[model samples]
Target: MDTRNITYFIAVFEHLHFTRAAELLGISQPTLSQQIRLLEAEVGMPLFDRIGKKVVATEAGRLLHQYGMKMLQAEMDAKNAIKELRSENRGTIRLAVLPSDLDFQLVPLFVDFKTRYPETSLQAFSTIFVREEVLAHKVDLGIGLSGSLDKRLVQVPLGSEPYELFVHSASELAKRQAITLEELTQHALVMYPKGYLGRDLVDNVCREQGFELNTVMEVGSASSLLQLVEAGIGATIQPKELLKQHPEWSHIVSIPIADPAPIRHLELTYYADRFISKAQQQLSESLIEFFKSRGVGEDLELRG
Candidate 1:
């Protein structure tokens, strides 16, 4: 019945080892066992099957685990709401950032944020995409080369990350300042896997140019695609700003794709109806300001 007991139970169920779970929860094994016993008594069911050193959750335990997580998350959300009301400057920002922004933009902003509001905690999740995270309310904000999501979500356009041809030094495509989407199809390609926004954008443009892409290889991350391009395997496409960091990859040339210059809009997405705490608002403002300061004003647009 107790929330603390539920927390302890979930931790134990997750690890299926009392000692390991206790360590993770920063408590003693004996104390953890006592709490789990108390939880089992309250529920009137055996939560675990113990045989030798192995432990497994019983059917009841598995069901409780699912509900227990939802209860705990709701409790945490309530606590966060109260904390937000007490202090405008002190709180956490739950952000889910795409991998490219992790290095190019988010890290530096995080450094500055820590210095400015040392009391604030930043919970950052760096993933390939954040649309699902935002929709699930697991993250308060998300940044990516994407646009709108479900109708429940609202997006603030930051900028368009111009797609450029990333080619290895010896590749014939590296000789040009720009290549049309029509010309891009002539070479072999390394592209993002299907369903990824970047890959979708490239596919859309190539389709517009009246041909399917010659994607010889497919990769999940921008880094892998770039590495493959560097290895002279095939050309790939990525944001111009991300490519700017690796000048040493001078072996690679990033030329803008012309004739319907393909680009993905990088946007900040969040649930429109959710409460925007001061910490969240400030972080969003900081991102907008940072973009303007970096002279990306021409590319970035702040959505109302």
Candidate 2:
């Protein structure tokens, strides 16, 4: 129950080894094990499963670790709040960034941010679960999938991004100017797992056209999907911005989806309750301005 014990528990869970966790925590292996046992006694359940040489978290351990991480992060956020008041220009800003955002938007934005706040540091995490991390205070801002979010979070709509069919130049479909939702079903497709916004859009269109989806390969990474498409193995659906950013995909052709393009809005997500430092606020403003200058700010909206 103690934060110190929770910290030790988190360290062990991260490394999944007593010696490594002890080294990281600056404590002896026996002491760390004793503390973990005391924590297990307090929680009334086993946290980890140590079988042979491997150490893994039990189901109970996973749940407790999630809560412990939130507690530790909240504590850090409180300290940062005080530091923000005392210090003028030196602090770390953690931002959870989506992979798609990195290639196109982040470099210029990062350059500007660093130029303005030279003393500040930026940590960018490539993640899809931005809202959860923001609420936990693990990140100050995040690039989220869609405009919709919980009432406790604040969001600024970046713009609506349409999914396009990425086909290999050698493929017959690449010669075509545009492709429809129905025609797209005829080819073997590379897609992400369910719950991804791009995947959801593909499913919606496929369902609307009255065809059972046939996936050739389910890929996890966006970069890998492009590689598969370029290899003529399968076609993938991705955002226009993402494809445009990666111009090195000369063999990969991007075709605009027709008969109602699959579009979803991208947004900036942050917790309303968390303190937004001056540098954070400035970066947010600059991002909004960047979007505006790009001529995609018509549907912009702010919500808490």
Candidate 3:
């Protein structure tokens, strides 16, 4: 029932290896094992079952893990609340963003936030699984494409933008103001790999329309994908906001997609019960304002 022991247990459960967990925790393997054993004895049940070299959590272990995370989160929230009472702008905010042009686009907003709260430590990284990261309490907040409803999360609608065909100014398609989804299939295209959220959004729409794009290249890096378009290699389908953010990429023109344009809905998500520090609250407001300034989420309702 010791919080320290519960911490050790969670570490071991996450890594599923004593030596690895011990190394991460900066403790010896024997010491970590002893802590786990003590925890198991205190709980009066086997927490893990060892099968050869593999370690698997038992039914009890899984149940403890579910509540253990909340307990630790609550403890941390209490500490953060106390700290905020002393100084409103002195805490760390961990944010996860979609691994695409959106990350680069938000750089200016991040810079402004840092300037306003110099004492606040902001750690932002790009990930494809923004929803999962936020749900697991791995990050204080996340910004990504709208996902399925989860009661544990507070999702604020950032805005929705239409997917447009991006091509080099010199490309033949650039002369057209808009292109139909069916016509887009006739041209060579470069896109994100299969599992990416943005790519999947467009793909799903294509499937619904009874067609698939003629993608000639699949590049995971957002910069590289745009570079391919700049090189006149192939067209790409992306949110129009992406090109609007990069004035340096003036050579690239985003033409609207007609006949039911694919739209990407963006949302800022965080745990509903998690304490929102002043720094986190301000940053969230900044994000909402930033998107509004860009003329993206005008019609979307603000929800938390």
Candidate 4:
């Protein structure tokens, strides 16, 4: 069985579309189909079942996919090992981070990283599904909410920050040092939708307190949420660090949430079995140091 065939099979299995997989692999649809047929012949079984336009993996295909990921990971490990022997620090490090963090929070850290490691390429994707991307091996690392029991992932605590009410400085709420979770219902609020991790955290806390937030608007973009707040559309609850990072938002004031403040715990997550290249390790270290300098997760500790 050629590793190349296994690679093609995995791509097709993931997309469940021949043309889509072919496009991703830089090959023609016929060439991809021929490769899959060759792989099926070599394995003595059909890997995918075609039901009309739907492509579903057969039992054999599922089994192959399980081990095929490991085989490819091993190949990557071997290449990384050889590259390490040559002391090469140049490679692409793909990472996924929450959109909220990417926009205003972690810009300085990324800038510093690129300045220090000009030879290495950094690709940062802003997404809400950080853990899913990391688990699927679509990204080398992820920065998002912690608390995963998946043994396949290694999560390092980044820090925890409390959710604060962000409002225009002229708002009455801004005059106070803090506000209770229940008090949020009294004011019109702009927030992320229910399914988003940040919104879910706040919703869960509200449910625990036996009340729901009076959200007047639901916006997906963090920056948009802030703009709405600035426009006096409504107040918003977000991590305290967001306001601290954006000093130019002088009109925006953040007041701490009291009566059981909601805190977002973040972690640096990556696949446990995947080999960590030197470049990846450096970036991870830089992230930890950056958080420490900002006094986030004050009791932070490095954990596997």
Question: Which is the leading candidate under lDDT?
Answer: 4
TM-score of each: 0.69, 0.75, 0.96, 0.93
Model 2 over residues 119-231: C-alpha lDDT tens digits?
88888898778777787667888877765558978988888767788999999898888988777668898888887756887788778778746779987778888888988
Report how far off residue 11 is in candidate 2 (Å): 5.9
Scored by lDDT, model 2 comes in at 0.82
Q: Report the lDDT tens digits of candidate 1 across residue range 1-304.
A: 9789998998888789999999999999999999988888989999999999999999999999877866776777688788777766577789998876685556778989888878888998988668778865678898866654457777777766677888887987767878887776788889988888777887888787688887889988777888899899999888777777556676788887885877777678877766677778889888877766755534554453
Q: What's the candidate order when arranged by decreasing lDDT?
A: 4, 3, 2, 1
Q: Could you report the Cα RMSD, in angstroms, for every candidate shown?
A: 5.2, 4.3, 1.4, 1.8
Which is the winner by lDDT between candidate 2 and candidate 4? 4
- RMSD of candidate 1 to the truth, in angstroms, is 5.2
The lDDT values for all models are 0.79, 0.82, 0.88, 0.90
TM-score for candidate 1, residues paired by index: 0.69
Model 3 alpha-carbon drift over 4 Å, by segment: 299-304
Prediction 3 global C-alpha lDDT: 0.88
Candidates 1 and 4: which is better by TM-score?
Answer: 4
Top-TM-score candidate index: 3
Task: Give model 1's clash tally.
Answer: 0
